[model samples]
Target: MKYLIPLLFAASPVLADAPVVENITYSDGRFDVTLSHGDTGWDDYADGWRVELADGTVLGTRVLAHPHVNEQPFTRSSQIMVPDGVTQVFIRASDNVGGWADDTVPFSPN
Candidate 1:
């Protein structure tokens, strides 16, 4: 799946909205990241989001299905076991056509 997301998005339009990290909530060992993107439809939508270490270890990912056209920006959470002493992680979003958004959301564990 890691190699497939980018290829899927690359086939779509280039003008699609980039996904943005709007909010993050950390509890215990889990996190909830809110993503904002312009979801056009099945052909163009925010496909997924993930939390990873700066070194590129993916902690968790939220897979989105269909398009949240009416919702505009939406929130979703992924639960993962974070290692002890790891204070921060990066959040990334992807659209069907645009692959990964250019912005990486940096979040600190709370």
Candidate 2:
């Protein structure tokens, strides 16, 4: 009975807090994505974001250089070479600790 509580406590750090994509905007082949996270410091922050197709083909990525500690929600843009005939794509956000979030934003390049 005592073994379970200690194990859960030890494994608690593995439960990652993923960053959230607040909004996504596309214009003239550029994607501006906004993300919000509980960025305490360099140890935990929203690291990067990407533009990709529905099939998981990454079109472009922006690696956020530093921690936005004071800035709660920030916006960044990237230019992706969205191929022809691809009318829609997905915007995904990531954290420095968790890698990537399963949440995807469906966007139309219209």
Candidate 3:
């Protein structure tokens, strides 16, 4: 049991926190996204968000200044002109330690 405790503690850092998308709104070639994250601090926090195409082309990125420690979930907006033929995009959140979150928001350009 002693060994198990240390192992779990070591693995805790690997279990990085990720940002979750609460809501999304797209209009006039702009995107307003609401995200929820367990931001601890600057060392490991949701640092920024991005808009990407289906093919993985990054359209735009919104850089977050500080960690949203108090704000469990926050909303941010970005104005990006998607490609003409692009019908859909992905909204992804990035963290300092874990990088981008696995939760990719599929956005419809309607």
Candidate 4:
């Protein structure tokens, strides 16, 4: 028998909302981030994401080149060098239409 798994994808046409950060993981000096957005077309989509410190300092950024119409809640990775004394960081995702999300996902790389 063949089994199938379900995927969570929410595609919206409203351009007033930002992409949501579905999940994130940290390893060594890199982060694998998953984001979900209502990407109708090229005019609006999840354009970028960034890693930052508690003090609002950005460490790294991953920019989405195009719309993920079929692949909602997509995952991408990027590397950021944390300072010697830093223990944790936060992630913020943005869309071309709505900019950054209201809440941020916190992560600790220890």
Question: Against the true structure, whose lDDT is highest?
Answer: 2
TM-score of every model? Answer: 0.81, 0.88, 0.83, 0.81
- Candidate 3 off by > 4 Å: 1-12
lDDT of candidate 1 over 1-110, digit per residue (tens): 79899999999756877788889888877777777777777888888988889988888888887788899568887677678888888888888888877778888885
lDDT of 3 by residue, 50-89 (tens): 9988778899998888888898789888898887777789
Q: Which pairs clash in model 4?
A: none
Quote the positional error of residue 97 for candidate 4 in Å: 0.7
Candidate 2, residue 36: how far the Cα is off, in Å: 0.4
Backbone clash count, each prediction separately: 1, 0, 0, 0
Q: Write the per-residue lDDT of candidate 2 for residues 8-100, one digit (tens) a residue.
A: 898887656888888888888788888999888999899999888999999889999889989878998888768989989888888888888
Which candidate ranks first by TM-score, i.e. highest? 2
Q: In terms of TM-score, how similar is model 4 to the real structure?
A: 0.81
Arrange candidates, best TM-score first.
Answer: 2, 3, 4, 1
Which has the higher TM-score value, candidate number 1 or candidate number 3? 3
CA displacement after TM-score superposition, residue 29 of candidate 1 (Å): 2.4
